[model samples]
Target: VTAVIENTAGQGTNMGFAFEQLAEIISQVEDKSRVGVCIDTCHTFTAGYDLRTKVVFDQTFAKFHEVIGWHYLRGIHLNDSKKELATRVDRHNSIGQGFLGMEIFEVLMNDPHFDQMPIILETPDDTLWSDEIRLLYSLIR
Candidate 1:
């Protein structure tokens, strides 16, 4: 079984807020393939990895690939943040209903890089999960 370490919102003294820290932690592992990383969209944005626009998404993910190799990516948590960018808060909102607009989600749904990864929805409202899933699926074009 693969053990996936997820990125966090970097609230207060949190350590996994940045890809650099995650890279450092991941680098220590003796068996690189045994463990992997799961990126949380909300946490990533709150930590300052911008995904508001395509260019920003490209830049942030490029940095992530540089710091933490793509071979170690296992999953993705698709969430919208209630807080603003670089806020270091972990508040989650419904998809396309928070600080992160719908465009990013639409782009992400179509991004081939995440095709094989397990995509999980972590919206604040559980009742909206079905709708969110449909919305995400509709973005795949």
Candidate 2:
């Protein structure tokens, strides 16, 4: 089973705000081989791990690898944030139309590390789903 970690947004006693927390949870699970993680882009960004730039993206993923290992990465919740980096807000916006911008998604879509992993859209606007899906597909190299 894959566990999707959520951002606390400075809310009441919420865990999984950091990658390490998720790692710890996975470590405690008895059936470790069957467990994995699903990272949400917006939550990750708002939690202070930047993915908007190539350098930052590399650094962020490196940190994740160090804390949780790449093998534990099962999927991605692909969403742009409505808040700026490190705000700890859990708001979602349409692709290329929020604080995360389009570059991050472009980089992620083209990255081989996430090649076969499922990337899900959590954008707020239902009317823009078609455009968002098309935009993400267009980023693939």
Candidate 3:
């Protein structure tokens, strides 16, 4: 079974706000090989990990790799945050319509590291799902 680590909005002594915490949690599991991580973009951004730029994105993932290792990266919750970077607020908006913008999504879509991982959308607008999906697919190249 995979252990999907979610970042908290700093609501009240909540845990998993940092990648290190997720690494520690996964490390404590007896069978580490069976465990994996699900990175939610909005939560991560809310937790203060900036992914808007390539340099920052690489740095953030580098930290994740340093702490948790890339083998445990199993999935991604592809959502944009309504709050600004490091706001510690868990608000998800539609793709390209939030603080995260569309650049990061395009970068992720083309990144070979996440090639086969499932990228799920958690945007608030149900009406824009089709359009969002198409936009994501179009960025695959």
Residue 16 of model 1: what lDDT? 90
Q: Model 1: C-alpha RMSD to truth?
A: 0.7
Runs of candidate 3 with Cα error greater than 4 angstroms are none
- TM-score, ranked from best to worst: 1, 3, 2
Tell me, by TM-score, which candidate is best.
1
| Rank order (by lDDT, best first) | 1, 3, 2
Q: Model 3 over residues 7-68: C-alpha lDDT tens digits?
A: 56554577787888888888789988778888889888889999997788889999989988
Clashing pairs in 1: none
Shift of residue 14 alpha carbon in model 3, Å: 1.6
C-alpha lDDT values of all predictions? 0.91, 0.84, 0.86
Clashing pairs in 2: none
Write model 1 residue lDDT over 40-132, tens digit each, in one string.
999999998999988899898899999898888899999999999999999999998999999899888888999888999988788999999
Measured against the true structure, the TM-scores of the candidates, in listed sequence, are: 0.97, 0.92, 0.94
Residue 100 lDDT (model 3): 91
